[model samples]
Target: MIPFHFTGARVLRPGGLIETPVGITEGRIVDAPCGRAVDASGFLLLPGIVDPHGDGFERHLAPRRGAMLDMGDGLAMLAVELAANGITTAMLAQFWSWEGGMRGPDFARAMLEAHAAVAPLQAVDLRVQLRVESHLLDDFDAIAACVERFGVGYVVFNDHLPHRQLSEGRKPPRLTGQALKSGRSPEAHLALMQALHQRSAEVGPAVAALVARLPGVRFGSHDDDSAERRAFWRALGAGISEFPETLEAAQAAVAAGEPVIMGAPNVVRGASHAGKVSAQALIGQGLCAALASDYHYPAPRQGALKLAETMGLEAAWALVSDGPARVLGMTDRGRIEAGLRADLLLLDPETGRVGATVAGGRLAYLGPEMASRFFG
Candidate 1:
């Protein structure tokens, strides 16, 4: 049993939050006091940010104009960066495309092994979001095995139709921005994308069946453009709309009980880098249930601040903590309650940067000097 108190902090309790000290015993929040003894003073005690999707792309994992980093190095870099950002849980959104060719395969294989090796040594909670690109349907066999072996919690349905998204009359470009990041030559990338498109049209029922067959995994559909389009696949057990491109698709997701997952960068920046609906509108309507960091590492934490700043503190915190927790089926940890796990974060209420992080009854992140006292 571990007992500690956080005084003068905003303790976000089940019913509501109060400026008080929280008591922890056996990793459970057993009590809270009106006038605290231990001085929390100015710390913001909030739930650890639950990131549904975001990858190591920023670490040159998917280098846009520069060289790619070693997979291990990328993961290591991301671990430290995210914890500091106040993200307690992260889902590394790995994009695997058959048209992606050799690099995709190499990165996927290496990252899986790297995940296994790094957890014991790392301080943060990192999870995997396997973004299965539909164009790469041919690699279904290899992918099924990977999901079974890895604890990839989220599986996304991504079909990037190159010829369709490009200029209507022109031949598909040899390499798009995404392909360049993957280090494929334009000609090779175009060829791979085209082949994958053909393979998708072939539309092997086997691939769809395999997707449904994979257990212990939740299904997410990416870049949903319309409600009709979104529903067609949700009927097939696809429960997540990763980046709904339009209001109708987002509404469609809500009506069907599927959560809408948008990028935090989109919400904070007021627009999508890709041409998509505004995240701000989605959040205003309560249409958005979760916010993933996406390609930006600090967006999740910053997004929370932006939300609180724009909408109000109580509401903004709800989006980052309670909203995402409910969507992910993580009821216990998201809201501060008596019986929930002690996965929590301490940040400055004014600024959103995470100052300390706790997970599974252990203080995972602390200041450089006190680190010894907690981890000692």
Candidate 2:
């Protein structure tokens, strides 16, 4: 690959924004000569986004109920979307749940296999994050084996069962639709949910044993609703809090030095659709560490720009890049520094649009307006 040098750009350096040339050589940013030069004047050059957790690709994998696309094709398309949005490192959050079909263990294993096969073909650094349902006690051993076989680096605990409804002996809302998607009868699904809810006591120990068996892997907790719940997850070695549902939970995570991740849509929308804690409030209070795209593919850049209205550019950008990289224990590609990976983005400062995106020293995406600058 030919070396590329970007000059006349307002680069986001460690100190602040500076007008200087950035060089890329052999996939790393370096203070070296270049084979080709691109004029990046009047553009804001920042680090490419490192999304720590996102399930936006779920739509691509299974666009409709019982209709699924090949995982490799889904992931390839996902890479383009990530590149277009200036994301270089992405953790695709795939669920291993008791929810029957796509969210079940079989689909999880299939996703891992497809990821292993297609990840090498994509420009973005695609990593797997296994989102395991806390109530899947029976699949703990198999899940652990899958993690080992796939070398999954991140694992997060999620409990989405409607405990209130289950304990009341009533079928959860939308039981028929969920059952159809899972290829199970509504009666069977209701029975399964009831069984899982009844075994909640044993599930905790089973989860603890599962975590104990998988030592040295990064773990996270989802939808923490209280300080006590956050503490419980912390004790289980889950140092990352994903989408803390309450201000207290977010505060607890922050106080304990855990990174709290909120959805980028919350920042862009100015409120959480779930009517939980506001992401902007969390950011303002220094409680939110990162803003992931969540279910939307284009929210990170737009959300950061929206947040820049209050927190300035560098601080807002950190929520999508540096903060997430730190949370994931990846110190390689989050910032624009010499010797780090050359994952960077050039944006229209005024429009807040991505003009070009370079991942691992390769120009993975280029917008039409900037076409002449590089191609001419």
Candidate 3:
């Protein structure tokens, strides 16, 4: 890789943005320039986005029903989108649920294998985060084995089953649509949900045991809706809270010293589409630790910039960068400092669009406007 000196841009640092020339060499930020100088006079150099959880790659993997032919190629295409969105390190959230199609255990395994094979060839650093259905007790052992086999470090527990509706012997909303996606008849899907709902008593212990088995992996709870729900997961050694649906859940997680991750869409939209707690509200109360892309790759950048309207760019950007890096236990990237991995984004100050992106000191994306600065 060729080294480059980025000059004249307002580089975002731990303190704030400053008119400091940045140097990158051998995939690390350096104090002295070692290669060609690039005049980034009109750009705002900031840390590349570090997205903790996003499943937008699912679209590329299976663009149509039963259309998942080549996962490697899909992942290759996903990398371009990640780079274009200025995401350096991203956790591709894949579901290991009872759902039989793209989100099933089989599809999750294939996605992990494909990512392992194709990530090395991409400029962005891609990792997998398995979103396991908490009530899938029958598959806990298999999930553990898959995690070990793929060297997956992050896992989040999810419970999407409509327990209330099932307990009341009522049909859940969208049952038919969900059943079709899972390749099951409506009757079979309802039966499965009822069966899983009946085993709710077993899920807590089973999930705790699974966490005990994977001592080295990071565990989190998703869509926590109450303080008790957050506490239950925290007691099971799951320290991270991903997208707490209520302010109570978020506050509980934060009070427990666990990092609370909210969806970037929630921040950008100023409210949750599901009518849950507002991410902006949580941010205002100092309950949120980081922001994840959720299902949109561009959201983190847009969310942070939107937040910069009030909190200042440095603190708001941290939610998408250093905060998430810390949540995932990654110490190498997410900051524009000497001796760190050179993961960076250059944005147009006037329009706030990403002009260029560099991941691990390699040029990942260069917009047409920024081409002359690098090549001329």
For this target, which candidate reaches the highest TM-score against the unseen true structure?
A: 3
Q: Candidate 2: where is the Cα deviation over 4 Å? A: 65-69
lDDT of 2 by residue, 1-376 (tens): 6898988889998777998889999899986547788899999999999998899998878887656658788888889999999999999999999886778888888889999999987778999999999988888889999999999999999998999988887768999999988889999988888888888888667777888898878998999999999998888788899999999999999998888999999988989998999999999999998999898868999999998887788899999999999988888978999999999999999888899998988888899867889998
Question: By summed lDDT, which 10 consecutive residues of candidate 1 come out lowest?
Answer: 30-39
Q: What CA RMSD would you report for each candidate?
A: 3.7, 1.3, 1.0
Global lDDT of model 1: 0.72
Better of 2 and 3 by lDDT: 3
Per-residue lDDT for 250-346 in model 1, tens only? 9989987789988899977889988789988998987898888887878877887888767775677677777777777777777677677777877
Question: How do all the candidates rank in terms of lDDT, highest first?
Answer: 3, 2, 1
Clashing pairs in 3: none
Error of 2 at 312 (Å): 0.8
> Candidate 3 lDDT, tens digit per residue, 1-376?
8888889899999999898889998899986766888888988999999999999998999999668789999999998899888999999999999977988988888898898899999889999999999998999999999999988999999998998899888999999999999989999999998999899999888988999999899999999999999999999988999999998899899888999999999988889999999999999999988999998999999999999999999999999999999999999988998999999999987887899999998999999978877776
Number of clashes recorded per candidate: 2, 0, 0
Q: In candidate 2, what residue range of length 10 has the lowest lDDT sum?
A: 62-71
Off by over 4 Å in 3: 66-68
| Candidate order, TM-score descending | 3, 2, 1
